[model samples]
Target chain A: MPVMDKLKAVSGTAAIVGVAESDQIGRTPDKGPLELHAEAGRNALADAGIDKSEVDGVFTAGYSTYDVAEYLGITPHFTDSTSVGGSSFVIHIAHAIAAIQAGYCEVALITHGQTGRSDRARAGGNPGLPSAQYEVPYGIIGPPVAYSLAANRYMHQYGEDRTREAMANIAVSTRKWANMNEKAFFYDTPMSFDEYHDSRWISWPFHLPDCCLVTDAGAAIVITSAERAKSTRKGAVSILGAAEGHDHGILHQMPDLTRTWGRHSGPQALEMAGVTHDDLDLAMIYDSFTYTVLATLESLGFCGPGDGPDFVADQRTAPGGDFPLNTSGGGLSYTHPGMYGIFTVVEAVRQLRGETGQRQLDDCKLAMAHGTGGLLSSTGTVILGRD
Target chain B: MADGYNKPIPIPQPESDNYWEGTKAGELRLRHCDDCNQAYFYPRNICPECGNNNTSWIVASGNAKIHTFAIVHRPPHPGFMDDIPYVPAIVELEEGPKMATQIVNVEADPSKISIDMAVKVVFESITDEISLPKFEPA
Candidate 1:
């Protein structure tokens, strides 16, 4: 899914025909990552109305490609375990589409599951090489601290109130959507700017509401050649366009503090899909932190740099608003489970299929699913379409 | 400096041995590429810019500016509980490369750490083998 400027634009040849999540989300110590993967994988196969034997390709993040294959008892001709943090699954969709177009595989199944909270399997930070020498010495660090550096810089660049208000709105608004999702972990828990502002600071400029929930969850998406999707009884969500790129593996080395590879992949993907920001009916952005959403909204061209505050004001991304984002509650309130990239796509596909019961967007034609991994380190964008 | 530093310290790579050695001698050492004449941190043998093997260590002037920072209120590791609410900052060396280091010698106040504030390097000997280079207001 690495889209160099020289590569050809991605033609929409693959469609995600099925998407599913495990029966449980918040806590599942009874299920490990592999068990969660199998549960979601089998359910996704059923959702696609296809048999397990028909799958020719398999993809997942943070695990050996053979684990899912061996567990599900299928021999796939193609498999990818490209672990670039959370965005791996989004990148997998692009790779699966390319593989299908190249006839490397016929049907691709992508799976992700983690017991981040239940098993305490979450990594504090990258150890051994770079982060150890540079980042860790300062203190025990994690994504929140690294992300906070960017958010703190953003506040220094813009008006403090504006950026703070913007960050608060992102957390509050996402919770508003979570209020509509019965499955959301934060269901019935509404957030306001006052609560957000008063919340205890984890990292300066970040509060309890600012950070994503650490929960256990699993998700899967099944994609096939667009032509094959046309014959399925389920309405398919085509991969309109997709692109992936990395700016830096380490946060301090990020080229721009306020931007990410999203600044590039977002445009490359939209150009490939032949769509614009105005064309998107829904946006399922990875929200590990409130600042993450603000930075991404700017980088994805939804708003200008340092303009995220104005763009998110007055609850624009909340329910019954002009832009409906993270309708599945997102990682902020729904489920994070370490790598959240797949869940973003899962929600996008579900929304496009009109499977989101009460929080579903009306007449959703096109939606964008974007994921950020490793502190704005890797970014991937996938635009899905119903038509 | 404290004895028996019980933290996850960096194990010097053969490529970066010079950096750790230099830290022991109270110097901030970084790699320089002879091909492109660019200096960089986290010492590596090969020049990342020109892909040239003609790289060597050079002592840094220790002058820098705060690029950005965050005060970590929650300790992600048990080793850092005593140092909770620490300020971790990214600093820009006068020579152009940036690094991740803690901003010491001042209160870890959010309003105090303005971006681009002038800073200088100071060393804290973690163990007998390693002394970390931390930044403080110049």
Candidate 2:
């Protein structure tokens, strides 16, 4: 189906009823992944003014206490534990919509939490599937190296000087946004584009600033039908559109290093949301790496490929800029406890409700949130609006 | 089960059986779609572009370009602890398709690595049955 039609179908049918987040500012050495999940789940239920036992559907990505149904101690009529990299939560939202539309459940809860700070050893261990015993010996390790390769390719395709400077500008702009968000990890420590240029490289074409911060925390949200949402505790943030797409799981399978499935899925999402880029007041793009955000911006038609660096360099994405992106500082400065996709949904809801003090946009009507997973392998886009 | 080596053992599904066998034989293999005339890796049952199941495996020349890479000063896995500051790279194979592999015999310095630098594959024997493909400055 065409993107716009797909979007219109979901319009006003389902709304995010409540959004809540655990403390994301600092390390939480006392918590484990499951504990945070439960806390966030409870908080979201409270925000929705719904009974804890009323949630009949549970969805989660990344680390959880146990099976989502078991961890939350709810017998969900529908359950999804889809973990397709970091964007899993966004994908779950789309799944939840299908479940709700099908009458499988009246209310669903999506949650995520991680004690990435406490589990330093596991955090530092070779970052790959634990079951893949054959590939690790050859030294296919963590996410940084995997994404670095793509960043390197992007620099080669674009001019080296321009690519480096553009990415630094992305960091600088995101950090500037972070400065306004007290919850962001780097709220006080701001860096300039030039400083980003001079910072030591974690991988070729990527500075320290280009990488996201490893954080420990949890975030959760409650979703239901628009009618059910209105009768609940908080005002509903209606879901205009949601879509997910996959290119390939392994990096070796991707068609190109620079372009990704986002090229296809992003448009599909906007078309489904029945809105154009001009209609969007803010965008909360996943920022596992600075390049991912830049890449998605171009792929989603905000700009053309290789134009992301320059598009960001002119302050188009900064606070008060025409395109205010990552107002919560994104994963670059916010809590990136493993998979941070759920937080994007939370921030989008807060923005739509005009709940974000200081960081909120004037008369913000529409928003776009994107999540990426598995070596730039998959993309999930959710378009939200205020009724 | 070695302390520093967590080699990924292949549990071959029908689609990827040949690719795993090829890795065991130290030959990098990829699938060529008969309809689209395009090559792809991480072998799939259906051709991504043409949706043709009539695809065949072909040996790669092992020549590629450094699409991108990163130097890990901190090893996240205990298996990688000894290899602190190792180079993990994505190499775009000459045949098309990018592979995640390590770049050997190169400085881990960011300035030394350039995008699209020529690279060639080198096999590293992890265990008796597995010989993983890596890359070096070619």
Candidate 3:
């Protein structure tokens, strides 16, 4: 069979039965990374009303799946630790669905946790990696530097002044959504265009406001066969479609700075779901930086190249707008525990279940959660719908 | 070189040994595949394009143009503290493959740099065994 046909065969075969975030997400100085994982795993299992013993599969990013499985006291028959940065959780969802169809595992639990702010989880580097040899030696220090390079290319391709305005609009608009979400770290703090424009630069073309916060958090999701989801507590969100891919491992090797792998994955997953762009009620795109959202919008075929600035103008993605996006404040205003892909999935499932109180959309039947990891190197898209 | 010169050093693997030797001799090198008629970067044995093991080393002209750049205001490591605002860029070689390098002998200002600006390679010897490849405005 063709690759697309094989992907479509697994459509709606698995559903997300439960999703939860660790209590006290931001700034958990007391809890370690493993403790956060355990907490989230326990909470998600409860939300699904499924016994811990029923979990036959385990998945996690960052830490080894063996560690998470052992820590959670789960001898899962199937285990995966697909660590491709933040997109791992999103990819795990897709992998879990396929694994269930193959009878490799029935109930799969995916979890993520990091003490990014209080302890700075990701502080070291691997000297053996290609980045260390090539880019790191030339002062390509952190993610902001690599991401700013891409942003600079985008601005050069588009109008600089226009691009800056569009980025500011994203920051302010995402903050508006954050105001409605009480759990958001920036819930009480609102942002303005002036504030975004005036913020000091972390890397040129990227103000502090444009970057994601490095807070601590843990999130988990429970997936099982669609038939088993019928007995779950809440309405199961069907796994309509999903796809994961990458163009390069490092920033400089990217075929195009302004374009991401999402261009391929987004359309592929949407095709498998048999849905059009108009079918989506909300879009949960990763916001490691404001520029990420803009570039992703174009890459996902939501807009054309260089049209992102105009597409997001006038707070189009803000709450109560025509296009509801990042409804959970996103990583920009929400808690970003280093790896934020799980949170995007969590928010998508919540919106599909009408669990979002103030930020909930009316009759939200279908939603899309897109994740980008490692300086736009890795991309994963999951299209979810309510039964 | 300044004292306490703490910076990351490129360790050459077996496949990349020729490329590093070329850099140490102030020559930029790239891997080329005769099977696919293409040149690539980041030293590997197999041709990424054709998966052909029949590949050899070729000397790059060191002439290139800036594809993209970033002015890093915050340094990631203490070694880079002196250069508070540095320009790290990806330059497209005349051979087609791009490389990550620093733009030296220029101010770290957006107005002073741009995309597709022509540049030429310059070697900065950090140690006896390694000479980092850098670029400057043509």
Candidate 4:
């Protein structure tokens, strides 16, 4: 058997039994980060019909795993606090599968909550940290500044005018989805190409609308062995495959400005799942910035390099298009509370479960959720399916 | 760009002390691995290419090309507010490693700057202890 066949054994062994967000997303000044975690955890447990006491494995990012366990009132036999930026939660699902297979824990809960908007909290680093000393000193902090470097490079490699058009299309199309999603921050407001082009430049190559919203939100996921999932109230979405990787921590060190490790991880995930891009009914690629989606789509082999702008040119990824992407409005128009990875999974699970009210894709069976974190540094790709 | 030195100063680590020292002395230094026959930036003891501990410093030729960059209209640190619309970029050194630095001595405009444009190192003495390595069009 080939190496790819080895992953097939573990495929579909674990399933997501529950997925939920906090009571309120966007902005909630009353809720701290931990409280949002607990609210989402409570809702997810209720969704799974699993008692909080049943969760024996705890996985989270952006905070201490011990704190999450203490707040959730669970004593776990397994815990992983992998903090690879926004992609941590999606990576957690991959970790939960291995832990469950090892008999380390049967029930696992992965959670994320951040007060990015309410607290205005920025990810801190020690004074001696390389990023602080080198990258930050040059004013290359935050998503807009860091991500724009690559966006600029992408425009340089591709055509600048067409690339700008492609980016504007993402903002316009994604907002169209948000218009139908009452929970989306921009649900009431629609964006046009002229509006996106006219938005103020947060950084060159990135307009205000091109950046993700800084919202306060929380999301959670519960995973278990596929056998155990049979008894759950809501049918489980099988974790068909997952892969996580990073090429560099800082934006400058990235081998290619226009490409990411998504090139490697996306193929590995699809191969492990025994599925192809054609098999996916929905794609939940992280839209931290409009350029992120374009780069990721090309890296995932959905389109050829420098062809991203053309691929997304006419709002093809929007609702009522041939390829539906970011059906939950994505971080661009939806709520982005720091890490948007978990929400991608949440939205994918909802679409697979036929729970999305209006923006849902009909007959959505196979979905791929790709998460990009840091300065386009980390990536996690998870392929999911439902019977 | 600003009168006061309000921006952050690079805190030298044991691994990167020599690099900073070289910058202050008006020399851009890189870590060279004899085994791998390659040089890398943000100087550290271990060679990133081959994981070789037997490494030495070599002064860069001060020639590079713009790999990518962003004109930071919004300052991340309030200290950088005065330099609004400044260019922060990753320039690929002639020595083969990329480093984070500011593109100075040029207008911060799309028409003025581009990827693969030649640039050379220039030092800015921000404090008594540190001199930041900035780049300008060659």
Candidate 5:
């Protein structure tokens, strides 16, 4: 029983003392993917008031961990390059904590960046691998088509006005947050439900507004022992708990697209933290698509299988709403540079640390960051707390 | 968009040769696990369900229902420029394996496609070594 208690008490094992992003997010056409990683890493280390040499654990999904190490000139004793798509960095946080607890490394750095818009370095969709022989020939290539299949099915089983229209609420609500964020790509541009439905279709059931923005940006977070983090100049957010799991590598191969691994990972993550949904102050769910958020939210038990539409209706996730979701505008209106997962961590850390200027949640104590990767194929949830 | 249809062709791997050959012969086949009797797609020597190497192949009914579908206005690549506004779908074969395919012989409008709509497979020979199994209204 004592051993079980010890294992469960991972809340304060490690703390994120620093969170930073590359400068000039929306249109950094000059910088490449690696340059963005280097800048974000350097800036994050500076935020922690720590030196690059202090980083012994490196975690990244944007580029090879070895390349990240070389670019930052920090040779990490432990490295992770798990590329489950956008959710890799959030899932990597769980692994970073485990490695830190196990004494593999002290300070872990998780970084992500890409020139998804300007340079055509789009992330997530891996082409010409194994699935290519089967899926590619029929044009099951990218997320737009791959994920739209599931959305269309959900609309069919339920109803389009309920399911698909509910998805539009996410886009509109996300834009509402973007309007408040000076850094958001759509900061000046507001979205309306009518405009959302009228937008050109990339794939049926998913309009232009429903798709995530492709920008050039990078975000990173630095974590170390909770005790060590207390000495840093920045406020440290405790790593309460985190869990990661996957349903399928390829979207079509997923046995059930209606739900993701979030069903398992979300509960397991909250249980590890000894927290409940009621304890959460904010949620930063990956919004690669409106359906991505809905599918994950339902599976996380926030709503029933067919309840996503009503749950998000009336702009519940928008500003001045009960559920403060995607306070960073999410991928919908925020800068989604390939893998958007790391940015969610950055925003959650800021919200918990009370650093968010305008979109700050009052008396924020606990924040949830859920990352969905590979077209609802993989899910990772990390519960951060201000202890 | 290019004048020539330059869509990339699939080079058959050793394990998937049988499936490709079956498509060329105008027949749809899938691997069935002798241990678990689970039918799976994308032609592999080993059964994905039971991990049985001693799997047998069976000719599929080639009949499936539209599990889900999407009308892609933008092609993943420029090679598919000619095939814009196409409906790509995940169809569940009668044998229980889900295969990624395209729904053809239907109106171009997105509203025309519906889930669980009965469809059957048709072979399209892209090249000498490659043949694709497409689906259309039954």
Candidate 6:
């Protein structure tokens, strides 16, 4: 059988049955991360018309004091607390597929929440492993700095004169998409390419407008087999293909700072799903930084590596353009609660289901959702469709 | 002794002891797996490729080429504010492992740093307990 045929055999085998969120998310002084997660989880289950008792698995990313089984008041047959930075949610989807295919669990709930806006100013050392102590002391901190290194290198490798202007175009295009998304944090804040160029530099190549928002919010989704999804309250979004690849953990370990696992993983996912770039109607790429989205587009065969700047030029990524990207404003304009990967899956499913309201595409039958973790350490790509 | 300053230090573990010890001796050491013959840094007990536990610490030549880097104009943390517009780089070491280290002794001008500039290792003592390994133009 051909790859597409093989993929079609597994098509509709697993589906995301429901999705939900806890209110309009942002600087939520009234709530904590756990409360948002729990509320979103409850809402997802309610949307699926299923009770917590039926959930056999719970998957989450990052630190959490509330045990998945304990919070839901049921002992799950399987549990995964895999945290791979912002891309954890995308990885969670692949994990859910494995669990269902292995007969380990039937229904899995994946959720994310954070109080990033209020927590931004608070500074203390991250309490995990001290292996990075040597580098941390010299001031290599956070994703922005790490990604900035890659962005700077790309500019140097490929001429620098118009690079910032090219990047500004990308930010402007995303903002245009956000204007249609009422849920986005910067819905009313439309930005121009010139405005993006004039924005103060956060890290040389990366301007203030190029970075993603640090907003407080929570989102959850329910995944189960196609057989079970048929009985759910919401329509199903099929899992076409999913793949994850890791090159290195630390920024320095990357073979080439300008390139990432997305270059390798994105193509593999498309090949695995038996789909080509031409078949994709829309894309929800993880935009922790504008470079990430640009890199993914190039890696996924949308354009060549250095050609990303040209590919997204002239409002190409905006709605009514050749390729519609991040119709939900992406993390750049949307709420990013640290793990913004989950929202990519959520948004992709929404688009595939034609639930994006004004931001919805006219014919979004097939969609691609890409997520990155660590400092471009790991990448996960999932292709979703409605067949 | 001052606000927003804590003496940063590395706490060594079984997998990374040699790397820390190598720094004290002014040598950069990486772990080479006997099974796969692939050298790696950020010391792992087992080879990431072949999953072999038999590994040995080997001193590197400290020679490298700039693979990619970023010049940070903004400091995300208070500790880094003074070092704005500094270059944070990823260098491909001659020893066959890629390492993340600061590139020093080079003009901050973007025109100067190319994609594959040759570089060598230098050590900077940050605290009494730790000495960081950084790269400079070779």
Shift of residue B78 alpha carbon in model 3, Å? 2.0
TM-score of chain B of each: 0.95, 0.89, 0.96, 0.96, 0.93, 0.91
lDDT, residue A75, model 2: 84
- lDDT string, candidate 2, A1-387, tens digits: 444655567766888987888744358888777778888888899999988799988888775424655767888888888889888989888888989999999899998887776676553333333224323444555566567667767877777777776777667778888888788888899887677877886655567888888888888889999888889877788888888888776665567778877777677777777788888988999988888887778877888888887788777788878778888888887768778888888888888888888888898889988899888888888888896
CA lDDT, candidate 6, residue A136? 64
lDDT tens digits by residue: candidate 2, B16-90: 667667877878888888778889755776887777798888899999997777677655455676776888776
For model 4, the superposed segments whose C-alpha errors exceed 4 Å read A121-124, B1-3
Show how many residue pairs clash in every candidate, following the order shown: 0, 22, 0, 0, 0, 2
**Where is model 3 more than 4 Å wrong at Cα?**
A121-123
The alpha-carbon lDDT assigned to residue B55 of candidate 4 equals 89
Residue A272 displacement in candidate 6 (angstroms): 4.2
Residues A7-120 of candidate 4: C-alpha lDDT, one tens digit per residue: 889999999999999999999999999989989998998999999999999999988889998998889999999999999998898899999999999999998899889897
For model 3, the docking class works out as medium
Chain B TM-score of candidate number 4: 0.96
Q: Comparing 1 and 2 by DockQ, which wins?
A: 1
Docking class of 4: high
Model 6 pairs whose backbones collide: A149-B70, A252-B100
TM-score of each: 0.97, 0.87, 0.98, 0.98, 0.96, 0.89
Query: DockQ (Cα-based) per candidate?
Result: 0.72, 0.43, 0.79, 0.81, 0.69, 0.53
Query: Tens digits of per-residue lDDT for model 3 on A1-387?
Result: 229888888899899999999887888999988889989999999999998899999999889988998998899999999888989999999999989999999999999989888885345568667887889999886788899999999999998999999999999999999999998999999988888888898989899999998898999999999999999988589999999999999898888888999999899889999998989999999999999999999999999999999999999999988999999999999989888999999999999999999889999999999988897999999999996
> lDDT tens string, model 5, A101-192?
99999999998888888887323333446567777777877788888888888888778888877898899999999998999999999888
What's the i-RMS for candidate 1 in angstroms? Answer: 1.6
Interface RMSD of each: 1.6, 4.4, 1.1, 1.1, 1.8, 2.6
Worst 10 residues of 5 chain B by lDDT: B1-10
Cα lDDT listed for each candidate: 0.86, 0.78, 0.91, 0.91, 0.86, 0.79
